[model samples]
Structure formats: structure tokens, C-alpha cells
Target: MMPVQVVGLGLDGAQGLSPVLQSLVASAKLLVGSDRHLAYFPDHPAERLSLSDFHSALAAIVRAAEAGVSPIVVLTSGDPLFFGFGRVLLSHLSPEQVAFHPQVSSMQLAFSRIKVPWQDARLVSVHGRSLEALTQALQQGAEKLAVLTDPTNSPGAIARLLTSLDLPWQYDLWVAESLGGEDERVQQWPLAAAQQTTFAPLNVVILLRQTQAPVLPTALPLLGIPDVYFASFADRPGLMTKREVRVLALGELALPADTIWDVGAGTGSVAIEMARLGPASQIYAIEKTAAGVALIEDNARRFATPQVRAIAGRAPEALEGLPDPDRVFIGGSGGQLQPILSVCRDRLRPGGRVVLALATLEHLAEVSAWSREQGWHQRCLQVQLARSTAIASLTRFTPLNPITLVTLTRSEPSPL
Candidate 1:
């Protein structure tokens, strides 16, 4: 029986193929591939079979080869065995009748052009596949990654997805387009710039995570700043209030308060925002954990919130020495939700607002009961935010922890 030749072509096309592989294609009795792959051997005398249905095409090629076709060539892109059509062909054609000739894969060319080692890199393809693998790697903060792009999951779209994520780690993104071709272009792109720019349809995206701790960002928004800029606990990185929750809490606080208190301040995110909004106001950040206290102090200095004072003690006790607050934000009650509210009730000035960001239903119920018993004017805003992300060519939503921002104001005391 005649052997079936499975040849891998690179972006550079057949002109860059080895003499042996070129000769095999040049003298083929039958050839099979897509239009782009078939276009390379236009002048060849072989009977061309344009591949549409994979199984049907393979069946035809096998029949031709077994019927004494001298040479049957199947043109596929890059390393035929690696994420290529050779695997499918092997499933139907016997190993003895199929020979694989691999070229430089797009992933290999990508890392080579970016000048980064690929031995430890995670290679993923969004071509006709789900994006779960890629999403997992990104969430785990993988060091090096190479992504094969399809027309639907283009470089720009992937870049846009990356920027939208609220992950702690950061990456330097690069795109290698038309690798091994005359019009090849390689570029290191800023995530923001890449989100708006168009890249070639034939491309691979590279992500190299920054090794060093990211330098704290200097340019700050007047209200809510990105959470990545904050230095957080190494053990529990996502312990602080999220940006969406913080934004709503800040609005509820109605800033410019003469004195603002942030109870259970983990990273001082809420306290820092208060200081930013009313730079002249004194911002007190109270925390029970020493590590949290230190983070608050460091984040305070990092964000230029000099007015922020981090108290290294739990609430009810920590609230004793601080002056009466014009506004109070209880981010974490540390299981003392009621006690913290009681302390806040005693110290909060007339017309002052106390906003609590409760993540659990228990905390919400506790705070709600306390507010009603105290007969306080309350307004509650429940925020359930879902961030948009890309899973290959499809867009999916990842839900953030739901939070209820409850605003409380003291009124005439009522029956318990």
C-alpha cells in the first residue's frame, strides 16, 4: 500500500519547506488540505481535494492511497503531530501508511521572537476549543504563557479580557504575528494599548508575569482606585473590600466628613478612599490583626493618605480614643457586628452616616436588626457585580461576592 504523507507547513509556506518534503508535494498523485494550504502547490499536477468535512476528506485520501496512488500528500499547518490534523489522520490511517513531517509550530516561533524561554511556559489554543484551561492558568497567576489565537479569539479581544480581570498579578503582554513569514511583526504591548489596537489574524499572544512586586501606582483617581495598587496580605490577598463595593460605600458615606472611621480595615482601602476624597479630614483605620494594621499604615503612605491613622486593635475598644466621627464605614466586623454598630452609634455625630459593607447574610441580618432596634434611618444597597471575561471566542461572566451596603443614621430611640 502507498504511504500517506502528512506535511506540516509554516506561515512561510512551501517555499520554506525542506527539499525532501517539497519534492514529495511536487510529485504527489493526490493532495488534501484547506484553500490556504492547497494554494501553496498551485502548479503541481496532483489531484487536489479541498478539505471541508474532516472525516470525509480523510476517507477519500485513504481510498486514493490504498488504490495505488503513488504519493498522497496532506498539507497541515506547523508541527503536524502537535495540535494539528495529523492526529486525526492517524486515527483512521494505519501508522505504517502515514508519515508525519513537522515544521516550526506557531507557539515555538512566538517565544523565540519574544526572546523568552518556553520550556516552562504553558501553551494554550483557543482554536475550536473551550477557554477553561486558559482562564484557570490566568487565575493561578502562571509565570509564562503562549496563546494560539483564532479569528474569533483575536489578540485584541484577549487583551481586552485580561485588562477586565481583577487579579492581583500583572503581566507584560506581547504579540507575534505572521511568524516565519515575510510580513512578520512582533510587538510588546501595554494591555490598555493592545485592547484598542488590531492585530493580524495569524498571531500568538505571549504573557510574561512580572517577577518583582509591582511598584505601587502613583496616579490615583479621586474616588475608587484599582485594588491591585494596594499592598495586601500575602496569605489572604483578596481580603480587602472590592472596588465596586468600595465605590458604593464611599457614595453612601457622603464624604467631606470632618472625621471618618474605617472599622476592621484590612488594607485601608475604604479609609484611604475617604482620605483621598476629603484630604483635610482625619481617617482612622482600626484593625485587630497586626499584619492588617501594618498593611493599612503602608497603604496609607503608599496612597499619600497622611491623614489616615491605623489603630492596631479591634473595634469598640479601638473606637474609644478616636474623636467622634462624622462618617463611619464598617468593612469587616470580625464577628462583632452588633458591638461595632453600638460603638459607632455612640460616637457618630448628629447627621453623620454609618455605612456597613456586609458580605455574609449573617452580618446583614445582624446589622439590620441593630439598625431597626436603634430606630435609625437606614438605606440599604445590595450590589451583585459580575465582571465580563473572555472564554476563547465567547464572553462569560464571573460573579463577585455579593455585598450589601447599609447606611444608618441615628434617630429617636425606639423599643428594642
Candidate 2:
């Protein structure tokens, strides 16, 4: 039987190739690999074959073995088991027919240079996958990521994606290019600056989650922090609902790990906070002002809630093309409370929850009457917050703005 050895060349350096691996490469009757790997065995008389297609390469290896070749060598990069070509070849060829020789991976070298432990980090190859998947992971606030990048999905592309998401935190990126080569270079920069760079074709992208990770929590808190804790834009200033009021509204909304719509979302404080509660859930902060949209993005990054998306147009108009929400929160309706509620009632999933926060009793009456007309159960709460502030070198009590909370739960009619 022909001896087939799968050799891993760690970053193409002399130290990365073992003596045994070197001997195998020297004795092989046929060498199958990329041009760079073939260059390693310049003295070997074996027929140098380039692997551009998997089927063609496999055919060449099998043909050499049938022709009385005692040994065949297939070259790969890094550890054969770690996102290398060995896995694919092994599936096509019997395990008993092949032997693997691994080397330290470039990923390991890159992480080592940065002095960060990577045993727990998530490693992904963007070689042939959609960049959208990376976006999804980023939205979930993936702390440690090692992205294997090509020229198409380079560090610049990643920076653009993060910038478009409007996440507030800065990323400390390490770009390691031409690793193990004499010309290898490793550079660190902020995400914005990284976007402006043009890295070598071969490189890895490392993101160090900064200290300012969003305030968003990974798990849902039974009672969330008050809305006052979130940073909001000055345009809608005090228009945001208080933390106590939001908790009551969220309770009635019964949020699920599906999708949500925060209509008239001022600064997107609630939307971002909701995303933090459930990483899998998608929160759309629908607001009309440019400043409000920017605020939502800032809050999402500040809280580490990447799942919150800010829509910069007005409701009814902005609501178009958004995923149907499992639950809806209407924070400020601008006198269109009834119309917005009417639209949301029809759009909401069956048995879904809708919570409305209003400052005036008149809007509460309007929403309550509308809910009753729709055969839905409505609940109301008047929340007043009295906070303590510093006065004359002593603490004094001050009243926070009072809010009227209304919630409507819709249920399907049961069979008579």
C-alpha cells in the first residue's frame, strides 16, 4: 500500500517543519500542495503538483499511488485539524490510508504576540462564508473573535460593518500579516483607523473587547436597571420612560427571544436594553429623527447590545420592511397613539403583548378605550419616582417625572 502523509507547514518557516516531516517530503514520489508549499522541497525529484481544485488534486494523489509510488505527501498550513485542508481530504480518503503531521498554527502565533489567552475565544473562517454571519456574531457582542481573512473580507470590511452598526465602543484590532515570513508584520489600531488600512492579502483579524463593553447584560434581569441609567440624546431629553415604568411595561409585554419593535423609540434606550436581556432577540428602535437614530446606536454599543437596530425614519413609514415583532413597546406616539396601536395590534403575533407609556391621562383614556374596542385586556399604572439629590451639603428628596403606563395583551378567541 502506498504511504500517504499529510504534512502541516506552520507559516512556511524552517522551524515550523519537523525533521520527520522534512524527510517524508524529500522521499515522496509526488508532492501535492499550493505553490508556496511546493517551494519548500526544491531538491525533491517528486512531481510537483499544484492543488487548485479538490477533485483534481485527489485524482493526482490516487494516480501516483496506483503507479507504484511508495510515498505521497500532501501539504497544508497550520494544524491539519484546525480549519485546514486535512479534514476535507480525510473525508474523501480513508483514515487508515493517511498520516497527519501538524505544526503550530498561525492563529496561535498571532494570539501569543498579543499576550491574550485564546483557549475560550471563538474562531471563525471567513474564507468562503458570508460576512453577514460575522455581523450576527458581532451584534451578539462576541468578546473574543479570531477571523481568518482574505482580501475580499479583510480587516477593512470588518471595520465598515462595525461602523455601520453604530456601536459606540472602540475596538483594538491586531492585524497579523504574512505570518512566519521574514516580511511578516503585526500592527494594532482602533477600528476606525483599521478601516483606513490596506493589509497584506494574507492576514488574521483579532478584536480585543475593550473595557467599555456595552452596559447590556447577557441574561435577562427579572427587573432591569432604570432608563435613567442609559445615555440619551438631548432632542427627546426627558421623554424616555423611567426604569420603574419600563419594568412594568416589559412585564406586561412578555418579551420573547424572537423580535421586538420599540415604536417612537427616543434614543433607543428601551430597545437596546431589551436586546441585552436576550442576545437572540432582535430589537428594532423605530425613531423619526436622525439624532434619535444616532442615540440608539450609541446606547447599543454602550450597553453591549448589538442586536438593537435603529431605524432613522418616522413610524408607520419606518415600520415598513422590519421583522414582525413578537412584542411591541410604544414609548412616544406623538398624538398618533391610537393609529400606532391599531397598526401594531394587527402586526403583532397572535397572543403577543403591546405596552404603551404615556405622560397624559387623556392618551391613557384613548388607548384604554381603543383596547376595549379591539376586545383586548388593558392594564394601567401610574408610576411616580422620588429621587434624592444633594442640597446644602445634605441629601434632599426630589421627584422624578411621573409616567402613565398602559399595556394591552391580545388573545385569540377560544372555540365556543
Candidate 3:
């Protein structure tokens, strides 16, 4: 009777095969794998069965076994049973008809290269699966992850998806490519930088969460982040939007926005909030002041919203070179309200929304006029919020600044 074996060969190629496995392969009447794997043993006398077509390869293997072709070896990469074809082969063939020899999996080698123990990591294969697997892993707080990636679901694609999730900034990403092979590459990158990088198609990705859990547990539905959660100018406590107003503005922004721009992003409170609310959105925080820029960066990193890109130039000028936004939040105009409004109106995508957090009536009047001139639908709400404060013997209600939230949306055309 023929003895079928699935030998795992990873990146080490022929050198990784053991002497016993080598002997078995040298004696086999049939061998199967991709062309690259077969190329490793050029002198072997076995009849080659390429894996380009699963049905053809399976038929050939079965026919060989039925004809009593001794020592039939099917070569594969890494651990054959893990996200590999060995599992499928076992389901089709009897245990007595097959045996498996597993080399170090690429996932194992990836973690070894990083010198991190990964017994607890969630092993996800994006080869033929949706990215929702990754989203579920992150949302469930799996701190350590090792992903098996394919050409389509590349490391860059995975990074962008993760960044788009608006997860707290807590992971250090490592890409391990061509493990155990010549020209193997292993590098680490921040999520933002990873989104802009290109990696070899064959790679393993390891994500190590910088911390055990989010510093502030994301309150369900992602709102009501306290003003003190962000880093702001100590003397300018009022610079941030009060939690109540921030939530209202977030509601008006009608989240799950594809793209958002947070103009005058003081301490990035509103921008960060928008990011958390709409994880799939690209949120840009544009601030003109050096201190504001620094604060936005610090807060974005602190909150794990690296997706919230902070620009250091004033609006209208800074807004240049940015993508058309699905939602624009103007919190500080730097007295360029009219010009900023004009640019926002021009850059806003069709059916997009613009929200302005105005402390002054002048800015409100300018925005309302612009909405009218542009023929966009407009709505305004004045948010008056008061929080409880404690004195020696009593709790008193302290009122915060009232903000006028102006929302403008372009009208969808009537049916012809």
C-alpha cells in the first residue's frame, strides 16, 4: 500500500527538510506542491503534481495512491494543519493513508524573530477570509495577534483597516516577511506609518498591544469623554468642548462618516471623539497654533486614534491638499470664518454634512448665510449645559459656555 506524507517546508526550503524526510522524498513515486517547492529538489525522480488546481492535484494524488505508488509526498509550507491544506487532505483521505510532518510555522518563526512569547495570540488567517475577523479580534480586546496574510489582504491593508477602526492607540505592529529565507525582512511600524508602507506579499503580521487595556474604557456607544481626558493648555480649560456639547455635535455629525475634518481642533477633543464614534472615517484635525498642534498629537496618541491626523497650518490654507470631506467640523476659524466656510462648502462631498461649533453669533451668521447662498439645508441648536460642583456642604450646578451647533447638508436632487 502507498504511504502518503505531507511535509511542511517553510522558508528554509530544502535545507529545512530532515534527513529522514529527504530520504522519503527521494524514494517517493509522486510529489505535489507549488512549482517553487518542487524546484527545491530538482534532481528528485518523483513525478511532479503541481498544486495550481486543487481538483487535478487531488485526483492525481488519489490515482497514485490507488495504483500503490509508494512514498507519495505532498510538500507544503509551515505547519500543514494550520490554515493549510493538510486539514482538507485528511478530511478526504483516511488517517492510515496519510501522515504529516510539520516544520516551524511562519507564525511561530514570526514571533520567534520578535522574541515575544505568543501562546495567547489570536491566530487569524486573512487568506480567504473577510477583514471582519480582524475587527472582531481587536474589538474583543485580543492584545496579541498573529495574522496570516495573502497578497490581497496585505500587511498595509490590514494596518489601514485597523487604523480605520478608531481603536485606542495601544499596539506596536511588526511585519515578518519571508521568514527563514534569504532577504527576509522584519520591521516594526506605527499604525499611521504602516498605512503608508509597502510590504512583500508573503508575510506574517504580529501586533503587540502597548498596554493591557484602554486607559479609559470606551464607554458604550463612544461618548461623554470627560474634558480632563485630553491634554489642553492648563489656563484654557474652556478650550475643549464640554462633554455634553461634544456628544450633541457628534450626533449632528451623523457618524460612520467616510471622512471628517476637525478644523480648529482644540486639544483634538472633538476630532478624537469623532474618530471613536466613526471608526471607519478618516479624521483630520487642523490647528494653526503650535501648542494646539502639539496638544492634538499628544491627545491623539494618548487616546489611540492615530487616524486623527493633525495638521499644523491654519484652515483655508491648511485645508488645501486634503481630500473632499464627508463631514467637516469647524470649531475655531481664526477669524477666517467666511473663507473657511467657502472652502468647506466647496470641498464637502455631495450629501456630506458640515457642523460648526460657534461661541459667537458672528460665526453663526456667517455660516448660516453661506448655507443659504449654497442652497444647502441647514439646522442650528443652542446647547446649554450645566454640571454639578461640590462645595464644603453642598453640590451646586455650574453652567458651562453655551455652544451653537450649526449643521448644513447639501440637498439630494429630486427624482426626474
Q: Which candidate is the best by TM-score?
A: 1
lDDT of 2 by residue, 1-416 (tens): 33678888855544567687677777887888888777776677877789877688887777676566667888888787888888787776678777888887879989987889999777888876667566555544566888888777788877766555433333567898988787799888776787778888778988865544345556545456644446654323345666666676776666554989999888776786577667899888888877778778887877678889888887777787987888889997766777788778778887677888888878888887898799997777788876543221234444656787776777643322
Alpha-carbon local distance difference test for all models = 0.82, 0.73, 0.80
Cα TM-score per model = 0.68, 0.56, 0.55
Candidate 3 C-alpha lDDT tens digits along 97-133: 9988899999998998999999988999888776667
Query: Clash pairs of candidate 1?
Result: none
Off by over 4 Å in 3: 212-416
* Candidate order by decreasing TM-score: 1, 2, 3
Clashes of each: 0, 7, 3
Over 4 Å off, model 2: 12-15, 66-68, 168-170, 213-416
Cα lDDT of candidate 2 equals 0.73
Q: Which pairs of residues collide in candidate 3?
A: 168-304, 169-304, 170-210
Which has the better TM-score: candidate 1, or candidate 3? 1
lDDT of 1 by residue, 56-122 (tens): 8878987887787867888998988887888888787789888888888988888888778899998
